[model samples]
Target: MTSIQEKIIALKHKKNALILAHFYQTMDIQEIADHVGDSFELARRAQTATQPVIVLCGVRFMAESAKILNPTKTVLLPAADAGCAMADMITPEDVKRLRAEHPDAAVMCYVNSSAGVKAECDICCTSSSAVQIAKSLQEQRIIFVPDQNLGAYVASQVPEKEFIFFHGFCPIHHQVKPRDVMEAKNAHPEALVLVHPECTIDVLEMADFVGSTAAILDYVQNSPKNEFIIGTEMGIVERIKQTIPQKSVYLLSTKMVCYDMKKTRIEDVLKCLEQDIHEIDLPEAEMKGAYKSLERMVSVR
Candidate 1:
C-alpha cells in the first residue's frame, strides 16, 4: 500500500504541482504541502505560482479563490465537501438584498465566503488584512458581510470607520466559552493566550494576542513565553508542537475542531491527486468580477 506522502511526492513530480494548505488541515496534509497559510496568503501565493496545478488542502471556497486568481492553472481540492459554514451563511441573493436596503454602503466581503458572494462584493479581506482593507476604503460606509465576529474585531481596531455587519459567525470559534478562557488561564498563568479574531468580542477582550492563524504562528515563534493557549482549531496545536518542541501548547477547549476543515483526509487527497478529478471551476464572467474584488484587496495591501 502506498502512503499519502509517497503519492503526494509522486504527484508533485508528475504534475509540477504545488500543494497549498490551510492551518486547519491535518498534520499529515500540512507536512506534505508545499505551502501552508491562511486564505489571503494562499491566494497571493497561488497568483504568482509557476506550477501547473494547485492542490488546495483547505475548503471549497479557498480552492475557488485560487481558481479565480489563477484562471489559467488547474486548481484541485481534496474533498469537494470540505466547506466553511460561515462562508455558507451569506449568498449572492443575501448580498443583493442587503445592498437594496443600504444602497449607500459598499460591500467588503471576507475571503472565506463563496465565489458567488465574493462576486457581489466591492472588495475582499481576510482576518489579518480586514483592518487594513476596511481603512483603505473612504468612498462610502462599509457593509462587512459573513463573519460578524471578524467584522466587529476589525471595527474595533479601526473605529474611525463604521462597518455595518451581517449577522453571521464561525461556529467553531463562536462556541468557545469565557469560562474556558478562565480555566486555561488558571492552569497556565504564564502562557500567552493567542486567539483568532473570528472569536466573539469577549474572547477577543480576554486574549493576550488577537490575530489570524499566520499571525498566531509568528507570535508563538517569536514570543518570550515558552507556553501558550491557542484559541483556534485543534490542528494548530500539532503544528506548534512540531515547530517548537520545547514549548507547551494548549487549546482553550477540546471542542475546537471544524468538521468541514477536517472532512478532507489523506486518502481523499491522494485519490484526488491520482485521478485529477473534482476540479473547481469559476465562470469566466464570475471570475472576472471576483478577481476585481480580490485585486482591490491585493493592490491596496
Candidate 2:
C-alpha cells in the first residue's frame, strides 16, 4: 500500500472510523470504504454505526443525511464543495410554498434533497424506493420535490396517485438525451440498456431496466446477460469492473460523469481523516424531524 493510504488506514483504526461511500465515488475511495452504496444505503449504514466517527465520501447532502441519522457521531465530509445541483436547487421555503398551494397533498422528498427540506416532508424516498414509497403514502395527491424526472417516473408506475413536481434535476443525468440511448443501443446491439430513473422518461422508455445505482449494480450482478449499457454515473462502471470483472459494462452516455461526486479525491479523504475537516452538523429539531420521513420510508417497505 502507498504510505499515505497506510497512514489513512492506521488513523481509521485509531479513531474507529467508518467510511460511507456513494456508488459515484472514485475507485480508490470506494476501495477503502467500509460501506459503498447510494444515499439511502449510506444513511442506513450511519443509523447502525457503532463507530464514533464517520467519513462520507460523497456529496454534501449525503453527509448531511449521515449526520441526520448519526447525530451523536462525528460526520466529516471529504470535499466541502461537493454539492449536488438538484439538492441545492430547492430549500425549505419551496417546500412551504408547495404545501401552501397544495394544502391537501402530502410531501414526498427524494433523498437527494437537503435535510431541511426533508424536515418539512411527509416522507423521504430514494430512487430505488420512490415508487413503493409514493405508492405506500395514503394521500391521493403528492408533491414530489427536487428531481422532477424521478418523480414523473414514479408517477408513471403508480397511476393511482397524482403528482405535483418541483423543477429540479441532476445536471449530469439531465445531459443524457433519448437519442443518446438509441445511439448506444445501435452501437452495442448485444448489450442490455439499464438506466437510472433520474433520466428523462424518453431515455427511461428505451432502457431495458430502470432503477437506482444499487439496483443497477444488483441487476448486472444477477442478470444472465453478459454485456450491458449502464446509464448512471461513471463511477458505477468502476464498481462494476471491480465486483463483476467477468461482465462487460459500458457507459450509456459519456456525459454521465458527476463532477461533484468526482470532487473528493484520495488526498481529500486522507486530509479529512487527519484534520477532521468539513464536519456535518444539523440542528437537533431538523435532524429528528427529518429522520421521521426517512423512518416512514423504511417502515413502508
Candidate 3:
C-alpha cells in the first residue's frame, strides 16, 4: 500500500495538480506540497502556475482565492469547514453597509475574507503586504475591513493615510494578553521573541521580530539564537521544529492554536486528493470583481 506521502505524489502526477499549502498545514502535507507559504504568497504562486488542478491545503478563503485567480483550474480544499474566524468577522453585507456610510472611501478587504466580501472590495491584502497596498492608494479615506488589529498596525505605520477601522480580530491572538508577554519573557529568559503583526500592539511591541508565517520561519532558520519563543499558532512551532531540527523552539503560550486551521488534517488532504471532493466554486461575475481587487493587491509590490 502507498503511504500518504507516496499517494499524494502519485495523485499530483495523475491530476497534473499543484499543491499550494499554508505554513500551518501538517509537516507531511507541507513536505509533499509543491509550495508552502502564507496566503498571499500561495495565491501568487497559484496564479502563476500552469497546473490545471490547485489543491489548497489551507483555509476556505485561500482555496477560494486560488479558484478566483485561476478560474479555469480546479481548486480543492482538503476540508470545506476549515474556515477563519477573522474572515467570518465581516461579510458582504457588512461591506455594503460600510460603503453606504462612507460613499467615497475605497474598501480594502483582507485576503482572509470570503469571495463575497472580496467581490465588494476595491482591493485585497495579506498581512505582509497590507501596508504597501494601502499606502499605494491615493484615496483620502480607506475602509480596512474585518481585521481591526491589522488595520491598527497598518494605520500606525502609515500615519499619512486615513483608515476606517473594523471591529474584528483573530480570537486566538486576541486572547494573548499583555501579561502573557511578561510571563513568556520571565519563563524564557534566553529565548528571543518573534510575533505576528496580527497580534495586538502590546505583543508586537515586545517582539524581537514581526512578520508573517513564512517570515517567522525565515527569521528562526537564520537567527543566531538557537532558542526562541514563538507567538503565533502551534503549526508555526511545528514548521520551525521540522525545518530547524537543531534549534530549541517554544511557544509563548499554549493558547494560540486556530481550531479552524486544525480542521484540515493529512488524512483529509489525501482523501481530497484522491476523491477531488469539496471543489471550490465562484461565479464569473463575482470572480471578475474579486479578481480586480486581488490583481490590484499583487500589483502593489
Best by TM-score: 2
Candidate 1 — which residues are off by over 4 angstroms?
none
Off by over 4 Å in 2: none
What is the Cα-based lDDT of residue 80 in candidate 2?
Answer: 96
Encode model 1's per-residue lDDT on 78-163: one tens digit a residue: 89988899988888999999889889888999998988899999999988899988888875588999999999999898888767
Colliding pairs, model 3: none
TM-score of 1: 0.97
Candidate 2 lDDT over 1-301, as tens digits, reads 6777778888999999998899999888887889899887888898889999999999998898888876889999999999888999999999999999999999999999888999999999999899988878889999999899999899999999999999999898888998898899899999999999999998899899999999999999999999999999999998999999999999998888999999999999999999988999888888988989887876776
Q: For each candidate, what TM-score against the reference?
A: 0.97, 0.98, 0.96
Looking at model 1, residue 118 earns an lDDT score of 90
Best-fitting candidate, scored by lDDT: 2
Backbone clashes in candidate 3 total: 0
The full ranking of all candidates by lDDT, starting with the best, is 2, 1, 3
Ten contiguous residues minimizing lDDT sum, candidate 2: 292-301
Q: Lowest-scoring 10 consecutive residues by lDDT in candidate 3?
A: 1-10
Clashes of each: 0, 0, 0
Task: Please provide, for model 3 over 1-301, each residue's C-alpha lDDT reduced to its tens digit, 9 standing for 90 to 100.
Answer: 3387888898899989898888877677788888989988998998998998899989999998998888889899999999999988888899999999999898998898989899999999998999888888889799998889888888888899789988989998878987898898899899899988789988888889888888888898998898898989888899888878999888888999888888888888889888989899887888998999998898887
Better of 1 and 2 by TM-score: 2
Cα distance off (Å), candidate 2, residue 156: 0.7
